[model samples]
Target: MRSKVSIQKLTMSYYLKDRVVTALNGIDLEIADGEFLVVVGLSGCGKTTLLNILAGFIKPTGGEILLDGKPIAQAGLMNRGVVFQEYALFPWRTALQNVEFGLEMKGVDRKNRREIALKYLDLVHLTNFTNIYPHHLSGGMKQRVAVARAYAYEPEFMLMDEPFGALDAQTRESLQALTVEVWQKTRKTIFYVTHNIGEAVYLADRIIVLAGQPGRIYKEIRVDLPRPRDSFDPRYVELERETTRAVRQG
Candidate 1:
């Protein structure tokens, strides 16, 4: 697969009081085009930091990022879409309007934006809730809106930070299936961060594990399980166990 994004010796650090906290250290990675990549580890492993840098929300303290062979100095919504665990929907905007928000910002005409938003709402199976507000929707429904909003913008890649973390077990599983369905249809390169080893194994074509305290890549595991993986299958169980052990060791 062709490289969509490349990181070379990536490092990040921040200062607090008289001390410095290193978030990432000498991280090198290559994300393939249309690949589903998941980053997993314990808290403070710089998973979110990596996702933030990839989204161009924060500049690395060292190293550089290349997007499609070009240096990415602060890419905005045009090139990347972010879906946070919090959903980040506008309370004032209806679900349809929330999905249309990015298109509106990009100056997409009303008719086109509405059409695109509706298409993605259908993709996430949320078409019936398009007129509802965030406060009126369930947690999973709100995340679906968030996913639709991200997809409506038509970005080449999606940066997801534990998007299903807040949901109940059943809802999370359902959303995971929805996310895979959307990914299969869109084929967008996805970089997702999560602490759930099972979820990562279930969703990713590849997994990168980060170790904490100036986090760095600890392991890279390629999951070759057949799509629509069975969580109860022995192979899936084995991989999940290995991934969990790697995270624990990290």
Candidate 2:
């Protein structure tokens, strides 16, 4: 598979108050172009730190991250888009404005940005609430808006940090289905960090399990449950159980 993003001996540490605490220890990962890779681990397992480094949101203490064979020097709009665990929608901006914000930053004119934003909103089935404020939207609706915002940006890769972690089970399932549809349609490479074993099994092309105090990749499992998966299927349950054990025992 072609690598869209590659990490070489990636390491991260925080020198907080002159104490060196390693967050990532000699890690390497490659996310293929148009692949959906889900990562599962216990809390504080450095999954979020890994995504942050890939996004250039946090500089790694050691090693490097490359996007499309080039070094990721800094945060740039062209590089990637991130969906937060918490829907980081701007409260003051309506759904449409929030989606258009990225285009505006890219210097796309008002006429074009609005057109693109609405198109994304429609794609996420949120066209009816384009004018709604973040506060007026439910948790699931807010997350859908955030997903639309990322799509509107037309990023080459997406880093999702448990985008559906805060939602109810039903909402999470719907969003997972919606995300798979978008991923198939756009072929955007995604590195999603989550703790949900079933969600990882249902969404990922491959699942990476991280373990240890300073997280390291424990196992890489290719999910062969097939697309449009049914969680009730025996194959799905089997893979989920295997992954869960790898994570717990790693």
* Model 1 C-alpha lDDT per residue in residues 1-250, reported as the tens digit of each score: 6589999999999879999999999999999999999999999889999998888888899998888888887555488999999988999999999999999988999999999999999999987999999999999999999999999999988999999999999999999999899999999999999999989999999999999988999999999998888999898998999899899898
Error of 2 at 77 (Å): 3.8
List candidate 1 stretches off by more than 4 Å.
none
- The global C-alpha lDDT for each of the candidates, from Candidate 1 onward, is 0.93, 0.91
TM value for model 2: 0.96
Report clash pairs, candidate 1.
none
RMSD of 1: 1.0
lDDT of 1: 0.93
Worst lDDT 10-window in candidate 2: 70-79
Steric clashes per prediction: 0, 0
Candidate 1 shows a clash count of 0
Q: Tally clashing residue pairs in candidate 2.
A: 0
The digit string of per-residue lDDT tens for model 2 on 1-250 reads 6688888898899889968778889898888899899999999889998988888788898987888888887536466889997888999999999999999988899999999999999988998999999999999999999999988889999989999999999999999999998898889999999999999999999999999678899999999877899988998999989998999898
